[model samples]
Target: MEVRWDIFLIILGSALVTFLPRVLPLMVLSRMELPDWGIRWLNYVPISVMAALVGQELLLHDGQLAPLFTNLELMAAIPTFLVAIMTRSLLGTVVAGMISIMILRYFL
Candidate 1:
């Protein structure tokens, strides 16, 4: 099949638009020296956001507060948390969570 230049250009432009914001920060910050507090906060931000997102996704529904006992996601998270605390490995946590979810879903 022949390549369409117009379609390629549109895709390329959209790709550039999406990538520029993300690439620009790293490109600009690569040579800049960030303060200690800035670096510390940056390091923690990912973990904090991940925790919030995971908690929200598992426990909340429709932007409202929900109970954990009746929620499958939250129910699955329980085993995941226990394994994570005991094992301290991402792989183990993920596997435990997925398996728990599958078992729960299958039995329910």
Candidate 2:
């Protein structure tokens, strides 16, 4: 059996590229004591990112804004938003969103 050195190098390089960006921040940040205000702001990052992504999905379709009743993304998002508010659980919100989208796709 012959080992492909070119493929092996590509795979190794890919892993390093993928891993460094994610781990390097943690390695650098873990040693520092962040201020309370900094910590509070950092905590909002996930929710901000989620809102950006969800807003993009719900507001855009075929390079245009979709109407509320005709938009599956908007329809699914409403229930997901409610679930997030009611349960306050990230996992439950995500699950409810997925299930809502799946049902909307199947029936509508």
Candidate 3:
């Protein structure tokens, strides 16, 4: 069978396109300082992103709108929030959340 060089070239091109932006920042000049507001808000970015991801995953079951508190995700979030506030660590929150969710899942 003949090798598909065209497909290989397309895959290689797609890979480079995906990688360029990720590598570009690392290749650029010295450490840059974000503005004061940016610096202040940077810490919240991860939590915000986490919240969005968790929210989407929790609220969207079977590709349809669902009730909030009537789900595993929302139920797990309570313990996760308390753990995060108590521990003040992302890993701790994640672990706590996962454990709670898994235990709940196991039971029901």
Candidate 4:
């Protein structure tokens, strides 16, 4: 197989554009002490982002807001949410969600 130099350059440039924004902030902030309020607020970012992602998955269908029962993704989320609450294990919750969704997709 022949290597494509043009594609390689595009991938390299794309990666740099993505990587620099993330790395530059960490490098600049490494030695700085953040305010207490800022540290407290940053803690919520992960949960907020996860909630937004889960919301997008459960609530949207074909780029539209789907009705509650009619959404297969939302249906799958029910047991996933339960597993997350009960087990409190990330791996278990993910595996349960995947299995539930695959079964739901096959039947519904």
Best by TM-score: 1
Could you tell which candidate, 2 or 3, scores higher by TM-score? 2
The pairs that clash in candidate 3 are none
Q: How large is the C-alpha RMSD of every model relative to the true structure?
A: 2.1, 2.6, 3.2, 2.6
lDDT tens digits by residue: candidate 4, 1-108 = 998999999999999999999999999888799999989998999999989987997898879999987788888889999999999999999999999999999998
Estimate, for each residue in 1-108, the C-alpha lDDT of model 2 and write its tens digit. Answer: 999999999999999999999999999999999999999999999989978987887899977888887998888888998999999999999999999999999999
Residue 28 alpha-carbon offset, candidate 2, angstroms: 1.0
| Segments of candidate 1 deviating more than 4 angstroms | 1-5, 61-67
Candidates 1 and 4: which is better by TM-score? Answer: 1
- In order, candidate lDDTs are 0.92, 0.93, 0.85, 0.93
Model 3 lDDT vs. the true structure? 0.85
Off by over 4 Å in 3: 1-3, 24-47
lDDT score of model 1? 0.92
Highest-scoring model, lDDT: 2
Segments of candidate 4 deviating more than 4 angstroms: 1-12
Q: Give model 3's TM-score versus the native structure.
A: 0.68
State TM-scores per candidate: 0.81, 0.76, 0.68, 0.80
- Give residue 73's error in model 1 in angstroms: 1.1
